[model samples]
Target: MKIEGIVLIGIGAFMAVVSVGYWFWSGEPSGTAMLIGAVLLGLLPGGYYYWWAKRMKPRPEDRPDATTREGAGVIGSFPHGSIWPLVFGAGAFLFGLALAFGWWFLPPALGLMLVAATGVTTQSRRGGAI
Candidate 1:
């Protein structure tokens, strides 16, 4: 986590410096905005990982002397299949359509998202399809 954080920060910082130079050269607000966004793309995750790295005990991968066994733990069971993702995609598609076409699609879009959220939550809690 620490290493990941450092790398991300470096990436963000490098982009930021370049963005400053580009801003001065081109004097284009749009270009500066996009470059700053790139800076944020790195800084956000980097800051999160670095914060966690500081809070928790060192992870096995971070230690030079650590072995693979040091990181041993039970792996979690993943969901085999679920329809929630399709439901979400459908909702998102409708939402986009609403934004592009008209406000009438908003209701169905919101409803589908609601249904998906309920189904996924129920499935996780009951360990079965909803």
Candidate 2:
């Protein structure tokens, strides 16, 4: 994480410097905006990882005498198959289709999207498969 953060910061800084140089030479506002966005994008995750590494407890890898077996275990649980994605996809498709077809299709598509989003969000609370 620390290495990744450093790399991201470097990339962002490089982008910003190049963009600023380009803007000065060509006077393009688009490049300036892009550089600003790039800097923010790089800073957000870089800062997050730097903060996270500092705040987190030292892991097995951080210890000089730690064994490989010390890090072997279930890291976390993940959801398998779920129907909510399909529902959401259908709603999205309908919403897009409505843009070219008719405005009347918006209500049902939006409703399905909302319902599916709510169901996915609340599935863990209900102790159901996601």
Q: Rate the local accuracy (lDDT) of all candidates.
A: 0.91, 0.82
Candidate 1 positional error at 30, Å: 0.9
Every model's TM-score: 0.73, 0.82
> At residue 26, what lDDT does model 2 achieve?
87
Candidate 1 regions exceeding 4 Å error are 64-68, 93-106, 125-130
Residue by residue across 40-117, what tens digits does model 1's lDDT show?
999999999999999998878888999879978854546889999899889999999999999999999999999999
Best by lDDT: 1
- List residue ranges in candidate 2 displaced over 4 A: 57-68, 72-74, 125-130
